[model samples]
Target chain A: MTDQLSLTLAALADPTRRAMLLRLAAGTATVNELGAPFTLSQPAISKHIKVLERAGLISRGRLAQTRPCRLEPGKLLELNDFMDHFRVVTEQQMDQLETYLSELQAKGTEK
Target chain B: MTPAPLTVSRVFKAPIALVWAVHTDPKHQAKWLSPDNPEGYLSKLDFRVGGTHHYGAPGPDGAIMYGTQTFREIVPMKKVVLVQSFADKDGNIAPHPMAPTWPREILSTTDYEDLGNGTTRMAVTWVPFNATTVEEATFEGARAGMQGGWDHQFGQIEAYLAGL
Candidate 1:
């Protein structure tokens, strides 16, 4: 079962797709312009685009024939909280690591 | 494409060997890894190739979640690779407490780099191991978000959010 968070995460998983999101973040871009920086073929680019669209990370520009894509970041908050939890844990661990290291060295200096 | 691995890297003020000690020695791990209550077995480390290090710490919501590490490889003062999985309080392998779709086993590799000038850099890489399609997809998705998270290394997420 593809949960919303999972879908968002999976869409962002690909380096190409993530970049596409980043490019879209700067401004909207048609599929062609989005595909310009990489060597991926048109179909491959389209496939990546589809994944992002499916995740709700981006939306198609309805009026334009070129069908530019814009970053739809509403779904990202969900993933952000998840990733934030991860970062907080890792950050806490680092803090502990630093404290413990100091204690270890302090003991070492005593010997 | 092979799914992206969840990675965390940090520079420690201590030397490499000292930094490695905290990870390899149960006593040291108990000291640093403890979030709230570290159970008895959590401190009891079987540090060997093919050894199991069962541990428990408070998850995000402050309830304890159990997990275990089966060491696959160990390079002195350099790297340690293991299979990381969720476990019951008894240390039996179990599904994730929060996300059942979460992969049961994740291949975890941690590298200790001697950054010279009396400092160490610890890098960790995590990827689902022996996972099914859904498991892999979940992991890939988690990792994709983690990249922005990683900046959160992968750094445009904040800007992307702000620009919107």
Candidate 2:
């Protein structure tokens, strides 16, 4: 878990790398395909992909010697779990705020 | 692959200006933006075009979630376009500590429409920006999870408004 978290962080540390990840998310693409939007060189895009590959966020496949990328959904579950706590806490506080607001409204109406 | 855009919206029983104020005002933002972590803090907000917003929340395990956003566009009591990212203390993009696959930067656009009658409808759209295949995959793959997260967070906010 720690490794994946750190790896994810490492991959995100660079903006170019992050854009590469977003490109892959749309669908699997070759280095050439992914580099089209940014006009980055294939080598530069490959370097970014390498970082993601090391992070285990993606895996490259060989199809007639052409490597393509695809989105790996598993790692996101880990992220969802980590972010879940924030959602829970926020909900609880909102409930409390609701009660407080109600009382305030009641007092206002009484006046 | 082109990243798909993600959007979420909520309605609040408050004036449009008040809702806009809450979103743009540092003091008001600090109050409710951290619904999950009651102790979440809003460190700073410079709510203008080119300004920035910085906020943090503690995780269940006590790890901190620090995030920042630079305002790209701002329309008073109406709309805000910003580039947001999880960041370290220095305001540099950082991977989410818990999810290595999450996107580094999420471009978000928030719009507030006045429905009149003291009601404001707010919408926030989040899109993965400058992400890698894994990062993008991580975000796209977790649609259900993201929905669930928003359900809880927004539900809480709805409840909070109901009481008012």
Task: Flag regions of model 1 displaced more than 4 Å.
Answer: A36-42, A64-68, A89-91, A107-111, B1-11, B15-17, B35-44, B75-79, B92-102, B112-121, B133-157
Q: Candidate 2 residues A1-111, lDDT tens each?
A: 236754654555555665566566556788777667786777787888887788776788888666887555565345445546434543444443444334444676799
What DockQ does model 1 achieve?
0.44
Instruction: Residues B124-162, candidate 2: write the lDDT tens digits.
Output: 777787777767756654433346343344343334334
DockQ of each: 0.44, 0.07
Q: For candidate 1, lDDT tens digit of each residue in A10-106? A: 6765778877877776788999999999998899999999999998888998864998898786787766777766666666788888888988899
State what share of the real interface contacts each candidate retains. 0.53, 0.07
- DockQ of predicted candidate 2: 0.07
State each model's C-alpha RMSD to the native.
3.7, 11.0
What shift in Å separates residue A80 of candidate 2 from its native position after superposition? 6.0
TM-score of the first chain of model 2:
0.70
